[model samples]
Target chain A: MLVIEGLLKRYPDGFEALKGVDVTIEDGELVALIGPSGAGKSTLIRCVNRLVEPTEGTIELNELELTTLNRAGLRRARRRMAMIFQNYALVERLTVMENVLSGRLGSVGFFKSLFRRFPQDDVDNAFALLEKVGLEGLHDRRADALSGGQQQRVGIARALMQDPDILLVDEPTASLDPRTARQVMGLLADLCEEHGLAAIINIHDVPLARDYTDRILGLKAGELVFDGPPEELTDDVLPEIYGGEDWSKEPSEDDEEEEDIRSSGQFLAEEVL
Target chain B: MPVEQREDTVVWRRRDKRQAVIHWFVTLGIAAVVLWCFKLIADDTTWEFVWSAPEQGADLAIRMFLPEWFVDIPQLWRDGELWVHVAEYFRQRGLYAMELWDPLVDTIHIATLGTVLGVMIASPLAFLAARNTTPSTTFVRPIALALLVTSRSVNSLIWALLLVVIIGPGMLAGIIAIALRSVGFCGKLLYEAIEEIDENTRDAVKSTGASGMQVLTFGVIPQIAPAFAGISIYRWDINIREATILGLVGAGGIGMALQSAIDTLAWGQVSVIFLAILATVVLSEWVSAKARAAVT
Candidate 1:
């Protein structure tokens, strides 16, 4: 479980990206945090992991108090929570297998990481995770050579190798096309079920988030204005999230869950086209 | 956008009336301050006196040692006897004959060894010095800065001179000086390279709760390794040139040979050494360019 209380972040330049935000997520829940640009969706998610330090608050993940933990302690806490970035953030110079193996670095001793002498289990697990993401054959390929969608897939496999209890994704689909976005989100949804992991993702695609996630958390200007199941996410709630009407065609209750997205096949066509 | 709004006319010409009359006033003020200070220290007799600054600093050094045969030397041109020694150096064969190649080889050897050692030492030091990579900037930063400044400020020649006196003249003096100097050059440069790397990679690792050491190994090292290699290689080439000069103080290598020939006034041998040095420098330059390109 992840819990936040009276969380606030104010930049030294005086921009309040998060204002007294309070939220909690249960174990194995797939929570979609949806908001438009500069709405602090990413900031809120980052704060949970102590990436952007909360100026004042308590972020409790299991026994770890994120705000109170020193760098080393926070790093130990991080081993339990993996993060997927929008840009993938795979070290471009390293091969896919190396990138995946890096996920175990927090647990592996420092000398082992330097020498890249990850334990046999770690090596096997990395290869297995790569296979799970359907990047089995490209394990040794340079990360920069992969397509954006494929790179994000590699990012997911890397995160899973951490054996994290919770996963936070910040705009995982932002750089991807619509079809690819759907595919990645579907993968996340599948992983949540397969591993029984809790996931919080910051997303801009309202319709896609509605289709993929079990619950939705909406934010606008550093405040959580709406929290409910995906079925309750509607056109009315979007204006509250984005500060204006956008893609205003309301999805009927029957149409809230996308039937068009069946598998990677249909999603690839939308992505490529 | 219209050209008129974007472009402005150049102003070049200035009238005598528009000239800043305060220029002479500033110059006069500076001159007056200098003269005032001078007046406070010395009188007109000293000013009028012909100030013959002595060349005794380097020339008079070590004159009282050994034999009367090595005593007070006349200027080469003034004595008109320099050609005799030049002829003798060229004519002397076997052990007495100065071989430019020997010193050249030594200088190159010392430089290569020093550069390699320094780079090995500085690579991890740079990572420790980077504010983002290290656990604390408070300790490593000042220490790194101090190391860099001290290495750079104390010229390699000075290092060689001191070491030569302590360790006795040989290649070791040259090598130690080059290594010490290159540490400053490479550490300072490599640390900056580490600092300039994109924070995005580190951010993900941090988000995963990577330890400081873990982040450095996975997040920072891969990003900066290539550039670090390039910087260290560049410093190696620079140290090679410095190694040659270090021998002027009796360190070792081709410079020692060159200094001996110069001392003996062997223009023929000196010219031969110069040509060899020129070739080596050009070849090393090309090699350095290739090495740098490979890394970057």
Candidate 2:
């Protein structure tokens, strides 16, 4: 179970990313957060673990309020929450199994992990998690060598290795092909069912979200535009959330085809002056 | 458009300040060269100091400091002393000969121990130094920079001198000298490595409710391991050379005998020792390359 009430965050540049948005998820529920790009979807999920700190909000995750917890306390709380990244942020040099075991880093000491002296139980559990995600024999495989689909599967296994009570999946299928995306979504749905884990999946594809999740929470411009069962998600509501009168006018063509944006490292570092 | 027009259209532009900085350096270099030439002609300094035995060391030192021991010169070169003296040294310090065992092993052991120890100290310091990784550039970065400066400010010789006072005369001194130098080097390298890791990986770890320590270990360390290996191994090669020379300060290894041979102006013995040191360094370099390759 999770509770987020009046979660708000504003950028230093004065742009509000999450403007008093609120939502809650019951235990073992497969929920999809559908929105256009920059809909505060990512920001909402990021704030749950305090990755993007809220300007003013109380995020009650488990018993402790995330906004009030100190760094150590937050880390302890984080062990119960796992996030799947859009980019499948696997450590490139580490093997697939090693990357998965990193999910347990919060519970282990710095020296133990550094020296590869992790508890045998954690290692055994990591292998089991990998096997469940269909990467059974690829334990020793380098994370960078895997295909995008395989990497996402490993990402899932890594999150699952945490034995997370709540899963925050941000654009889990954003990079995969339609078939692979469906498979990833199905894998997530199945895991939530089997493990009784609450999951919030942020997705761009409306059709995919409708088909995959039992419930839908729609966001538009840092506001909860809609929240209801998937059956009630109508085309009339889509226009209000996405701002397109006709199918031809909709931005669906540009849906997942956003070009890879590589910001210049030199530009990011130094001031122009 | 014509080719000329196309070429003109593609004219490269430099940022004004960058161009000005480069121009300033060039102008300063030219002015210094002209002043030096003018002074040479005006002063009419004798060319004798360049070739004279007594003044050669001073002149070379002026160009760039030569070892103080090199001040003594025989004014002649011969192969018999070289042959007799070198054969004698090789036979006397059989432990130091290229074909023999202990000295070479000692050199590598010092280098390996120094590199590993330096990395252990520098790894955490690097995190504090990296502007992107550190929470406060004002607080953590200065401490990190101080560590780098302290490590690098004195060369391995000073470290050897210092260690000789504390630990006293042995491989410990050599190892300490190498480690101190490595701290400076690995700090700069690993900080850069830490800065270059993908932010997405960091964000992924942070979202897990992981602490700053967790982010560094799970997210940053895994990313930097290859680069860290490459840098440490590169320093490993440098330490091999430094370790041999460390004995000049009465630390340990082949340098003790090397300084003796050089002090006596026995070129043949010096030549033999130098060649042996060169071979040892080359072999270590090859091994370092293999180790780095395996890691990366």
True-contact fraction per candidate equals: 0.70, 0.68
Off by over 4 Å in 1: A70-72, A245-273, B1-98
Pick by TM-score: which candidate is best?
1
Give per-candidate clash totals.
7, 1
Predicted structure with the largest lDDT when compared to the true one: 2
- What is the Cα-based lDDT of residue B43 in candidate 1? 63
TM-score of chain B of each: 0.68, 0.71
| Pairs with steric clashes in candidate 1 | A75-B209, A78-B208, A78-B209, B103-B253, B103-B254, B104-B254, B107-B253
lDDT of 2 at B186: 92
lDDT string, candidate 2, B9-82, tens digits: 85334435567688899999999999999998867866575458668665534433232223332321232244
- lDDT by residue (A1-273, candidate 1, tens digit) is 899888889999999988888889899999999766677888888888777888988889875688988767777888999999999998989999988988887888878888889899999898888888888899889999999999999999989989999999988998997678888899999998999999999876666778888899988778888899998876566556665444343233343245454333223222322
lDDT of 1 at A273: 23
Tens digits of per-residue lDDT, candidate 1, B1-296, equal 11222257644434333244566677889999999988877764554333433444333332321222233336654688666655554465323434566777787899899999888877777777777776577886778777777887888899999999999999988899888888888888888998998788888766666677777777888898898888877887888778878878999987887788789865445556666778778778899999888876
lDDT (CA) per prediction: 0.79, 0.80
For model 1 chain B, give the 10-residue run with minimal summed lDDT. B60-69
